[model samples]
Target: MTLSNPADGRDDPYLWLEEIDGERAVAWVDAQNTRTDGFLVDESYQRDFDAVLKILDADDRIPFVGKSGDYLYNFWKDAEHPRGLWRRTTLESYRKDKPDWDVLLDIDALNKAEGISWAFAGAARSPDKTRALVSLSFNGTDAIEVREFDIATKSFVTDGFVIPKAKTQVSWVDDNTLLVGSAQTPDDSTEAGYTRTVKRWTRGTPLTAAETVFEVEKQDVAAWFGVNRRPGHEGLMFWRALDFTRSQIFVERKHGPHAGQRLQLELPEEISVGAEASDLLISPKQDWTVGDLTIPAGGLAVIDLASFLSGARDFDIVFKPTPERALQSWAETRHGIVLELLDNVRGRLSLLRRSEAGWRETPLPGLPDNATISAQNFGGEDDPKLGEDVLFTITGFTRPTTTALWNGRSAPEKLKSAPRNFDPEGIEVQQRHAVAEDGTKIPYFLIGKNLSMATAPRPTILYGYGGFEVSLTPSYMAIAGKLWLEHGHAYAIANIRGGGEFGPSWHLASRKNTKHVAHDDFAAVARDLANSGVTTATKLACHGGSNGGLLVGNMLTRYPNLFGAIWCSVPLLDMARYTKLLAGQSWIAEYGDPEIPDEWAYLQKFSPYHLAKAGQNYPPILITTNRTDDRVHPGHARKMVARLQELGCPAWFNETVAGGHSGAVDNSKQAQSQALGYAFLRRTIAK
Candidate 1:
């Protein structure tokens, strides 16, 4: 089969590669895998693979647990149980060095018994906690089969709820009723291949006979259903995600004179909603005006749920955004809410409680500052004893992660800590600034043993992802620490404008028609590293995956003279056809619709597949992806490599058969894929 570029009406020679499982494509992939193995996997490569795998499979690694009734549940995987074991233990036992865990499910044993490869996706427990809806993904794809399991028997319930694999979403309304949405074809799904409608399914009834509760437009992203069973605030909720950054919320009355009636919320599409006790929490991405009052963008405000539903316009602003400080996330406890804030790219935590007067805010005490802090609603919100439990994880570039719990009163108590996976002895982390063409100062974190160029420059890897409003903060680089940093090389994370480091405005400044500003910011950082003499162009390597893959793809094609090697993984390279592939349609709000002539004019400028030329001085690049990556189609990587190779440029390709968009299923596979990328960097730039 042959395909042609819609933009220029030119025949596309590598278009057949887009046939995911076609015999010709499979043969080509097998040959490419063998060739990549011959080029990368040597004695030295084995050493790199072993080091990464050991760290991944280490027994002493911290086991993170979440509360569910009487047990703290955890899913564990190691060399012994490569597929993993779902287990649980008591809080007292979890506090001990060696917890006495009770195994609930053995994935490897189940796979062997069924003669199939299935990865444990996750489990959603019922409110009673006696049963759970277990999701298993076949071959590591996003599509999953959900089965009901009994906690006591530790087995799937006979004749219980079972959903065949598709992009399924399940939420339990009670033990016998569920709000389900599943799609297996375009007729039942949105343009992005996600469930387009939600239905009410009762026990013992065929799913096809379930009552339709809500439906969304085929052009919209998707519709999701949720149940809010918070004491007196019980109701059914539905939300339509119009795009990545816009949504409309709805609430259905479960009990009352208005039972069975759904009410569309009076809210801006850009505003997000949450609930705690009897109060309604809202955060607007754009400034919102209610009556004569205005709440600035990125501010957190609250109003009584009863009053809000009754058309009351009284709202109390809890947290207002500053130029440097913005609300990152928040979690609810019994008596208060824990706020995660970002101050100039650093993490900060605050606690807010209700008083007779109004809301009172205080700084959370005894937690590390200048690090990434994630808080979750631990111990179910309704638990009588552990209702106020908030679990927090704290870590930095060199700091090993530590889990702590705050009981809504005292300082957080450290529960468990991770062992030092890599040697951090002579290393230092520094935050540097790069001045872009628009005079924007981009902040980046540089980690290295030494940052001097007095004698000679050192090899370095610069990484970035500048879209989707995703913030790239400080993180413990265990794999890189073992393979790259331990070798005395440097690593830097670029906090460019397209990220949420500075909140919504930061992201909006560099997206859509102005997306080139993000690539410009990344190039500015690359130049800053060289101008500072930290590394020369020939010794610098750039790496990014997914959306970040597109970042380095631009660096490879648009700024080839600045880097020695590029590692792009699971990327969206062929912008012209991206929207038509898998879930790519959902991201049109981010990249613009190429079907529109005006949009295509600008999109082509950033498309790496179209930018390749025969005589251009392109640097060596390794494009890697997974065959089962149903998110960003592998055709992006396949076609780009073919185009570059045909143009006589140095390019290599490697793809694994399993492992979704992340490109790995198990730790061993993850280590192998990672080792291949690091080996390519070592071979090309780390002389």
Candidate 2:
């Protein structure tokens, strides 16, 4: 794909850099890496790197776990175990400070024995939790190879179920059968490079002989299959049409007049479905008219699956969001359902149970204020028989994370807490609002010390991610606390539009044609900070990644006077060609297709790579990405850096050899990459 330059009717000269693994492209990357390393290998950068690495590799960090039968499993990586170790322990021992864990898999040892750098993707276990399908990836890419393993033997099952590396999905239907989706052939993948066919594979049979069960059009995003087994409900097979936003769901009938056949569900394409026992919970993203009843957007409703399957349209409204309160997530227990609500961007937990009258709500107590609360099913999301127990974590910008276990009748019991990585003695947090150009109120969080003294502006770094309906909430920042706050710098996070901070409306207000509204909201927050004497433009910097990188890219190109430095990581800079990049076609529903005439007219306005000109006074920029990132192509960062350097702008570039989209495979790599970023910020703005 070639991008047209409207001004001079020419093509981008740096387009050759898009050849990710070409000899010329690799040589260019190596040269850029050497230049960046030369500037960041000083004594100050080394000190910062060591400090961040120490905090990351600290053994006092909490080892969070997931319950499976009588064991609690966790994946851990430290100085000794760089790749990581998958281990498990008893619930009783897990509650203790130093639990005795049984190692199930050693990734470092496996890598050594196999002579490959295979990263752990994940594992899907059988119902009995004694066997699992372990997934391992090459260089941390999305494509992975799956092998069957027996927990009792602590070894892979020889000549057992195995799938070669491709974007694949698998679920255990029984000990002898599995519902699988994978690229059977080169032509069996969607345009987005995902599997378009699903099959049923039996034990002791060759994978090529697996029977094709379901398939979708290659133009669609992908297809997936799974088995849902609730406690009092019969097992159900689910097939999903994986479109970007609008899709269809079909369920296989186990025992009925249409047994062994798939039936399409009668529901709106914009609604989400969740099941627990006989209840079918629906959350609508847009207004839906069912029979004579209308369910508003952001509303929750429930219906009996038996009645629904029988063509019954009667439904009961379970919960409705007001202007300030919106449902975030829900999980099921033995006899009750837990609802997580976001009220004005703060989390609130509530319990719901069904009775003769209707579903009733019970208030949960002892939840800390000004912190984000995440609740999960006690065992796992797919636990067939979850009991009346839930696990939760509470965290804030200045407070470390604390994990707890909650029963229905009492306050949450504290299980473990993360040891403090930095001193929070004089830290303070405050919520402030900024009014956008369109008269919208944007909320943001500020963390710093001696805020009462406004005589002098402090060096500050502002962060934001304003797309994909992802909300940014308060969370502890250990590196920021130790490297910036302790040394007298302020940090701020903007809750801009295109985020689910308020509700579906908040995100819709800035999506598609109105994408510029999110950029305006972020700029408003920066101006608010400067006007309040929190910081000056000379001492202000901006940081973001992924969609957030797009956010900061716009700031540097359009409003460079507001920031002294810009750090963009794993960004999508060439908006004109984003849809043609890896996994980029699937996100067209979020970012409009630039191939269309109308969409390109609007998209070109924010295409940072195209907007960057030779005469603009752009801020100093540091673009970082990973060579193994299959999701967002690293060429976006490479091309942007090359364009800026040609324009005589101070630009630095770095790319790691592993870690995929995250740019970090382990604690040491994560710390080292972050240390380079922080060191650049200190030199450009804090000095």
Candidate 3:
């Protein structure tokens, strides 16, 4: 069988069905940095049983990308190796007395070796460098635990922490206080939903004294107790909320009875919100949007909460107007916030930081190669070509991660993840709509090497995450291009409802009782592709991680035959006991509260754990999660697999020792995991 590029405009689509599955698995990487290679992708690089835990710790410093600058910050802790979990300083709260720098949080600590138990997935010191929040999974009944740490004291308060019936969410309002947003847990309640809210906590209060700040009243934030992985925890939980639609800044009154209290902070209908809190720039226009919506997400503007929410009207709009560019980073230097933008998506270094008074744009440094980039892994890449600048893997459709950097200079690199084996000389990536049964035009990204009937039914894979308000964007991905498309595969990214693709509203469309919309959107895409003659169900596969994993699990139950194989990673399938599982108690906001009889009635209808039929003939499923997954309990997978097996369902389940929500502690280990995933995909679909 001869495989040709399908997008040559010949309308040829059906090509891969006749081709042998294992002969090769086609993967097309979008340009270079448009997609990223998730986990490690090497198959034969398997670690020995003893070496498994050791290898996962290799990529410890997988850096984070800083705003407005090229600097990346990454952290790694290895208990097996000499670089023990405690890299250096002693935490003040962990100290027996008022912390002295010399006094170790556990000077003669018993659990010192397993201290950093999990990845840096928990809270850390805020920009003020005053305090930090770290969550860890403990053995026995201690499913997961949170620590209110004091950076100044190098100690952490072990008590007074909130422990959910399942999981607890901590957002620091300031060094002295933090908010624990958790779903209500009932004596008879059961459902691993990301609904509900509140669980107010403070340092001196007894753990039992934690109070409820506010319950989300369950609207669609899709953030289940911070279940899904998205962006740095640095400030996601800002002390305030904004009128995302009208660009109205709703500030929590720092005075009065509500002094320093975290508020729901609703926004007017015409404001828009940038994904990040720092990027929550308010524009002057009453209505604006990114490219699709008509809200207040224009270039950038500054807003004050006291003026809007309090009706003070004390400030005007032009406090600081962002230039005609994306404000990539902002710095609170001696003068004011230094707004930096990378005007040219292709260049290394930023054009300049235009001062409020039109200051000269300072040149960012350059891109660093081999930079371990992630939403959280900040720091520089490993490449010298990028000198000392912040590194980014930038490319799309055809380009790869080109290196650049910023050493306090201006040059920065936009190219981060570039491809090596496959060439994107003629591939194409386009955005299209997959209309839902309810008349909603859900957007999805389609990528193919040759997309016509002559290239018809080419092997395809679709990915999604419709639960959390997490908007799927293009980033550098190397392995997908290498195996899935570069070899002649077509893939789709469904940006369905239950996601923040269009701000909070999009997610609301499919959260809680409306979660069916997410599954429907996924099925609709698969059906669209099959009916449109792009690919048939036999040649298609579906994948999702975290909440998206739940997407896959739900798909199998409702639309059993839509996919050939399902790769559900770190998924929460058992909704009933989820809130009752390790850390499961935290995510009531996204799913729903099962404690209340009415919420439980609705929750039971959609809860996968309760709804999984006994004799259903579901498709083959491959599930993965971290054993030390303090975020989404591994028990979700354990119980799920056990139930499936007992009920005579074909299930493949694997649990990594650590890596928070995701698995494969390091790149080498990550590669092995990827290889295993690829192998599983091939076994079910390609084979």
Candidate 4:
């Protein structure tokens, strides 16, 4: 029942906050409430802001692994702390300091700050935590750059195989070899995308001696990699494809030059991976490993670890209630899975143990149903059970994320909540679905209050991201929900088909030549809004980042009259030129192989760059791009803005000097972004 201001941390009675890491916890808080108008939640906390917050208080010596910032992905001593050290920490300092620690990776000389130096992925060490294999990114001709940094010494040792594309996460089978996957960079001119490659890397000299053990054909290359899974079952290898349908499990030999080369098995037939947490986990030195494996059919499949290595094994299916049609976050323990389930439209934590007696499902003793749980990635020195305990954050649909701790042994401890200036009861959000031109159903969430621009048109903001099988679910948005919902009460989110809403099938149905289906779906939604009495072209606004930006670009070209303003953030707008840009070649699977005539024909039909015309009635667009966006280059936003300006269109361009994809680095900056976005929308539509 305590309220506080975010700026001074002063106890204010105006705002209610549920402290997740501290004793004080507020029930309902929303970012949209920060504005004058906003969204709402049920008093029962049954359906509301569905964000996550976790709290733990076992040890004061260390910080809980905080959420990653763009520039400082590893510098989160905490994001919720009113005063935390993570804010001052930079990527350079983190890369410089960690080497002094015990068994830190030595990577100064070879792993340049200017050059690529990402942390290795899927390096499962022995039970003793002694030796580990490293896989990092290096830039080459066809491929940009990536290098492996030893976790123990923080040092770089060797070069990697030349992939015509970029690679992600290196999965280690032993101390010496790694499962390396490569993605082709895009062809900037013709919009050609390179096919992705998957192979193995052994301790050896670069290119001269590096070896490849597995290579998929060009025919089936959508170029996306999945989370590496190492089950307790011997020889059983599981990976969840990033751009595909199901989680494929393979069995290979444990030792040999050809080890892990052949795929002897695939499992969970008829099971397509769905919109779930990044729960593909590998146990360290355990005989049995549990993966929070999701099937498109809904729920989790706790498959038996012995099924891959042994002849017959028992597999269990845990369909934790997902009443909100939202995603679930779970952590694996030798004991079982600590599932942070979503119920009542908020987040809750429960422990499901895999014991000799079968499975044990228990909720955290004292934490209320309104509490939400977040899984900390980096290790902290709290109770071993503290690590096992799922962190829960509780807030109404109008709540900001807070932290809390729930070790299996004890009840729950509260932590700090979001700034008090924010309020949820001030706004209201409604989830609505609209049908597309192809009879495709598109789901969108609309948040607003006193919700109309009767005298004038109210500013309406819309956001969407529909690619890579990633679904944009309706959650407690710190800024979008607050700024747009509260201040303007005119914001909407369209869950288009390119996302993993229905399943992998939903994603694939909108890929390649059919990619226009996604754009069509978005436009259909926009058209519905204009026709539905929500708003019209002169007051309607659109926003999307990454792939969704591409969608926005198409909407501008195809149905230019449907919207008045556009906010394209770090978008992939130049489809014809995308495959030619840095790392652009890796996306052939999603956008289609532009090099081929057939694919080109299809892509040209909807590629935003090809569609941008001099006489086109383009919407007023504010294009935001990043200079150091290692993943999606800022060139996209830049080129599109330049094109619009050249065509005499009103284009406002903002190039983030630093930070990768997101222009902002910290929560404060992000909040400022919210203010700016809301202000922009208000200026354009809300009068």
Candidate 5:
């Protein structure tokens, strides 16, 4: 299975597959796809695809929306509109079951008119909400073109602001001015292919004439500029210097003694900032010493912007985390702030407001226990000067998502509810903790038919994404419910370390040199499941994607006998050369720099590509990726599968021609991919 380049004298073989779009590389991809389809695209797989597609393309799915002036805008995709449509409805109308929506832009129509495959990226509206800068991507790639559209006229503004295709960021400063983050020249990008400079572009001027207002080191991940248009805080510009978890925040003074000066906020690099009226809210990822006081990591603090600018070191603590609790997220509303807290991986919603005495907390209602609840500033959270309306969503393994709107004074009104795609009758969800190798109690959610301990073990799929501080919360899985659970299968979601389930410390516990802690934690969950008789090793499967892909890949190589099947999607397998591929360089803060000899020594131990050896029995694996994924290179999946095949191991690789890192452009495509994946798992673990 070893490959090497004799001409270059390098041991690593199959690097040619990294060519991506090269004719030879594409030919190789086609051959692999044909081979995989021969086995996976069977009659059962097609039936699953049809059933999943019906659920995905159903019109009953909830269309999430955000407030913009008098409208609640939403982007919708279904069987009829594959490319989707950016439409809006008045708040009053949106409150009704069948809202009268106004179609602002049709992506399919635009693609047809332009004779190109254009996916709607996003849109940023002007301060007055009369115009917007719409971003359109080709085949869902990161690179996009932004064009100005007049909201009132419902047409593209002729001779208006437009930026050509590139990985660009656009924020409207005013009706005629925009703050743009993009390449000034063809080479003006970071090693990770992100914009390193931001410019202020005005109407009726060429992009070259745009003034450079902010710039960062080319080695940094990216730089972005945004203007806070929250009432009294209008015209306040905030600039961020981003480099993975480390970042610097700067604010442009619009008033006071330092008017027109860009002042760097005195805060730790590992802190995230947000504006709450006239105050600056900070969430620190590391312990910060301010004057004589020490703010623990994962603590939320706030200081008046005026006082902070005037050399005040005193900060009011909004919320502090305990050993098992951490701040999940926070949003500012007109009357106060809403904090989403996770206590031992369970959700708790709280409201904070500035009182004459100090900051006060009030528990918000309407969320169920043992479920995941997420909240956002609904009507006034966007403006910070208007209303106190907030929108929140609640879901769990057995419960379908229910979105509601709350105004802090009344009971939250249900705005929409996702139709039951799968029957949950007799289904049960249990939260259990598995002791990790390091003695850390890892929390996981197990879902299946209600059964007693005397019942026999059932087929199961254990899922995990144990990196990037991403929390694995409870959510209804429609496809799993219909395709797997309905057929008497169980599902488990592992909330392992290197996740924000507990707090920053939980994530830091498994990052960098200790990255293997996450893999060990995942394996611990699998072992617990098997030992408890919920599922046995022979009937169990493992699934993950992106960083999670790396998780299951480790299981495939390091613990091949632990599971019957492995479903790795859009994975990073070639750790040795990951930094040199696509945006891999940006994640050195989390995964450690592979180029460093000391770091590579530890990384190589868990690197699936390097760890996979010949003459060793491995579990059935299905590795999937998208050809147009500009983030994680598809070559990682391609090379891993090819190497496994060379080792005489049974492996399947599916690379879609379109779609980005997500690997699906439309509902149909998404359903087909899921159908293929679930089918593989079923066939591999069949009794």
Candidate 6:
């Protein structure tokens, strides 16, 4: 088959599908959905859906909370409350089996009262915590409408601050003041459809009266602003995100002739900034060399604010990355810094503090090995006593999540544990390595009921998301455990390049022109699974979403024979026109600019849309997306499926009217989507 270039995507047959809500395009989607349901929806599918929903709405599930002034905030969704309930509880009550929750807002009630589908995105609390700027998303998209809410009264303020929906960021500067990053006009947004301007909005004033404080180039990714009201580091901060991995930091001058003016920080664009009491935290995404001192990439360093502002290159290096170790995240507590480190893709917790001589680092013990540990709330910002207590969650492939708390003096205490959703008596989890085409040992986790493969290869699903420096860590897949693993099927996660599993170097190794390295790495894992007898090409399927959707899309076009089916959701398939679709322009730094001829030459090689050819025996695929997805336009999925069908391939497309880039707004929608994919996989490969 001779392949024809998209020629900048102008000459494409299914280009009409790009009209996301067009009458003809929607009619096509409805037809496709009906056709998909005609075959996939059955007793087994319903059973799978119910089982997944049960896990999602389980009463015994851990209620993760974020620490506020006097309460721990949690947004909960259950069978009864599909929209969710924004509630809070005291730490004392939260430690119990059934915490006494005070519901501040009921989303279902709000949606019913307003006659609209509103999803509670989050709430940004005021400095005093008596008020909040609540964000509500329409059908769970990234864009949100911000409205002021009086927490004490538990209602939206009658004449309070309200910002109409768009890709916006809101942070409380004081009880009556807010620092907002949003597009005042359509022209104020970047090509990626994100806020390019920052404004200071005060209470009792029209939004148009808000003062513009900061702005960035229209070609930049976005502009951001915030006020740090921490105990000692109270000031205004601004950031200009040049791209995914590069940003410029600026601070408002406080006590000089330049007071009230923004001063750009003398730091590398690749390094991130944060405040730690009177100290400044800097984590370099790339190696930083300053005045004969060098801070390695992925290392954490801190210096006192006074010295840093007064031109000091000396920094207290607390953490450094190694070949197998990387700093995942860190938090500031009243007395110390809590570090979440990843050692060979496994979670490790540590604490750093200033001692008599200098800084000291200590490993946090009593953690479950081989499990992923994430800090839920590092309390102590408000009260020094609460700082001694830190909340975290632990989970793995087979183990359900357990939310734990670590006191300053002792081992972490398990506060709540999620009920086991699936039987794991015979399940086993193994961390294995698959050598990539370049001889790089790619790490992967294999979970299954049978691992030896002494008898026959089992039905397997390999999942991967290899972009944006995002690390794929292990988690308890409750739905997969009940839907796939309980039936003796196998699941594998490939920690390929273009991910931060091994830190910045690992991700940068495959970014831009070398992005194909990630696809090659994923294919290597699939081939290894087949060769190792864990699974065969005839029974193995691949799954990925968003960027992962792009990952498996490549697997389908580049190595179609390596697997039996593909499950892609909310994908970016049309690379040539990606920059013009929703948030695709923001990813130019990672995937390279397709508009550039030289870059497109390499990008076209990996573009699944352009690579798809007729007369090829491509495996069956179920491509799903959402009409309301403000990020990664749904056009990618719609166009790909149309082209595939035209080429006589086994392609199925499902476009949900609601949801966003995630493709499911709530649990019911999530369950239906999962069941559809699982059913499709079972029909095409599991048998």
Provide the RMSD of all predictions against the true structure, rounded to 1 decimal: 2.4, 2.3, 13.7, 14.9, 2.2, 1.9
Q: Candidate 5 overall Cα lDDT vs. reference?
A: 0.85
Better candidate by TM-score, 2 or 5: 5
lDDT of model 1 at position 189 = 94
| Model 2 spans with C-alpha error above 4 angstroms | 1-10, 236-242, 253-259, 380-385
> Model 6's lDDT to the true fold?
0.87
- lDDT tens readout by residue for model 5, 447-480: 8887544567889999999898899887878889
Which ranges in model 3 have alpha carbons more than 4 Å from their true place?
1-73, 76-311, 314-399, 402-426
Query: Model 3, range 1-687, lDDT digits (tens) per residue?
Result: 222222121331222211212132112111111121222233422422223334334332222223212212223344443222322222222122222222223311425655643323344444244455655544211234666566456666556344544444556555566666544454211233433455556768764577754443223332222211122212223222111122222233334344455454454444333322222344323343333433333334444443334443322222222222223333322222334432211222233233557535443343332122221112212221222333344444344544433344444423232224356655677667778898877777777776633665766788998876666655444566655676677888887888655544566677678887888998998888888777788778899988888888888778888777778887887665556554455466567656655556666565565456787877777777665555676656655655666678877766555455655343444555566676666667776
User: Where's the lowest-lDDT run of ten residues in candidate 1?
Assistant: 1-10
C-alpha TM-scores of all predictions? 0.97, 0.96, 0.58, 0.63, 0.97, 0.97
Clashes of each: 0, 0, 135, 88, 0, 1
Arranged by lDDT with the best first, the candidates are 6, 1, 5, 2, 3, 4
TM-score of 2: 0.96
lDDT of 1 by residue, 1-687 (tens): 212336432466788889899999889888888888888899888998999899889888899998977889999989978889999999999999999999999999999999988888889888889999999998789999999999999999999999999999998888899999888567679988898899899999998889988899999999887786655556887889898788889887555444677877788898778854566789888889999889888888889766677788799998888998888888777758789988888888898887899888897766665589889888774543226788999988889989998777677888998889889987888889999998989999888886543637788999999998899988788989988888899998999988889888888887778887888999999999999988999999999999899889999899999999999989989888888889999998898888887888788888898878778899899999998999999999998988998999888899988889975568888998889999899889996
**What is the TM-score (0 to 1) of candidate 1?**
0.97
- List per-prediction Cα lDDT, in the order shown: 0.86, 0.84, 0.50, 0.50, 0.85, 0.87
Error of 5 at 192 (Å): 1.2
Q: In terms of TM-score, how similar is model 5 to the real structure? A: 0.97
Regions more than 4 Å wrong, model 5: 1-9, 184-187, 235-242, 381-386
Residue 411 C-alpha lDDT in model 3: 41
Model 4 regions more than 4 Å off: 1-74, 77-249, 252-263, 268-303, 308-331, 334-387, 393-397, 408-412, 421-425, 438-441, 450-457, 481-486, 527-534, 664-683
**What local lDDT score does residue 81 receive in model 2, on the 0 to 100 scale?**
85
Better of 1 and 2 by TM-score: 1
